[model samples]
Target: MEYGCYVCNKIIKTGEKFTFTKEGPVHMDCFVAAERKKVPEGKAEYLRNLSMILDYELTMLVSLLSLKSEDKETSELIRRRINAIEKQAGETTGLIYNL
Candidate 1:
C-alpha cells in the first residue's frame, strides 16, 4: 500500500519513511523535527522523556513497516539520540530493563 504524507501530500510507500501520528501520516523528518521542537532548552529530563516517547513510537513504526523490512532501516538515529539523552541525564538503559 502507498501512504501519502498529510503534510506534503507526497505518495509514501511502506518503509519509504513516514511517521504515524495522531494528526495522521507525515514524513519521518517532519515528525522528528516536530517532536524535537516540543522540547524546551536545558531540559535534559524532558528530552529524555521525549526520547522514550519517540522510542516507543518508533517501535510502533517498525511494526507498521514490517512488510517493508526488506527496504527499511531501523530508527537507529532516534535510538542514538535517545541514548545520548539518557547519558546526559546520568540514566541507564537498564533503568527500565527490569520492568
Candidate 2:
C-alpha cells in the first residue's frame, strides 16, 4: 500500500520507509527533522526545509566519509551535529544507527 507524507503530501511508495505519527504517514526525513525541535509544530514549510537539509547533510556526509577515510575529526563533527538531532525513532532500516 502507498501512503502520503503529511508534511509534504508526497506519496511514500510501498517498501519505502515512513513513520506513523499522530498526524499520519510521514517520510523518515520529515519525521527526523520534526523531532529535532528546532522548528515550531504545524509549520509545514519549515519542516520541509529542515527535512531536505537533513537529507542533504546525510548524503554529503556519506560521500565525504567514503572518499576521505582518514578525516576522523571532521567526520566526528558531522556525526555530532546529526546526533544532536536528539531522539531515537522507529525506522525501517536494519541499522538502528541514527544520522
Candidate 3:
C-alpha cells in the first residue's frame, strides 16, 4: 500500500525512512528540514528565533499542564498560540522531497 507524507502531501514509496505521527506518516528528512525552517532568515536570526519559539512553547506547555480545571478560557488561549506557532514553523520550512 502507498502512504502519503504529512509534510509534502505526496505519496511515499517503499524503502523510505518515515515516522508515523497522529497526523500521518512523514518522511524523516522532511520532518527535520521542516523543523529547521521554523526561524527567520540568516543563521543568527534563525537560531535566535528558533530558541525563543522553543522556549515559549515549553513555557506554555508547562503552564497548560498546571492550569486549574476552571481556567478553561486561559488554557484555550494558550493552546491557540501554541498551534499558531507550530503552523508558522511548518510553513517557514519550505518543503523538499526526494525523488
Candidate 4:
C-alpha cells in the first residue's frame, strides 16, 4: 500500500524516518515542527490541568508496579498504602494474573 506525509503533503517513501499522530503518518521533522508550533500558547487552562493530572497518575502507576515487582526504593514510601489492595494470585478465587 502507498502512504503520504500528513504535514508535508508529500509521499512517505519506504525506508524514510516517520512518525504517527492521531491525524496520520508524517515525516519526523515535519511532525516535530508541527508539534513545536502548537505549544507555549497551547491547550486551554482546564485541558492543561487535566493533562497534568494524567501525567501524575501515570507516574503513580509506575511506582506501584515497581513495588509489586519488589524493587527497592527510598522515596516511594509515601504511597506505600496502596499495598492494602495488593493480592496474590488466587487470594480471591478466580482473580488470575492481577496487574
Distance from true location, Cα of 15 in model 4, Å: 1.4
Off by over 4 Å in 2: 38-99
RMSD of 2: 10.0
Candidate 2: tens digits of C-alpha lDDT, residues 8-84: 88998654545565678787776665565544456555545545654554454444434433589877875665454
Put down candidate 4 lDDT per residue, 1-99, tens digits, no spaces. 567988889998654545445577666557545654554554444334433443344344445555543445644553554343222111311111011
| Residue clash pairs of candidate 3 | none
lDDT of each: 0.51, 0.54, 0.55, 0.47
Better of 2 and 4 by lDDT: 2
In model 4, how large is the Cα lDDT of residue 48? Answer: 47
How high is the lDDT of residue 56 in model 2? 54
Local distance difference test, candidate 4? 0.47
Report the C-alpha displacement of residue 17, candidate 2, in angstroms: 1.3
**Candidate 2: which pairs clash?**
none
The CA lDDT at 89 in model 4 is: 12
**Model 3 lDDT per residue over 1-99, tens place:** 788998999888655545454567776556656655753354645554544554454455445545554588877876776577555434433222110
Clash total of candidate 4: 0
**TM-score versus the correct structure, for each prediction:** 0.39, 0.37, 0.37, 0.39
Sort all candidates by lDDT, best to worst.
3, 2, 1, 4
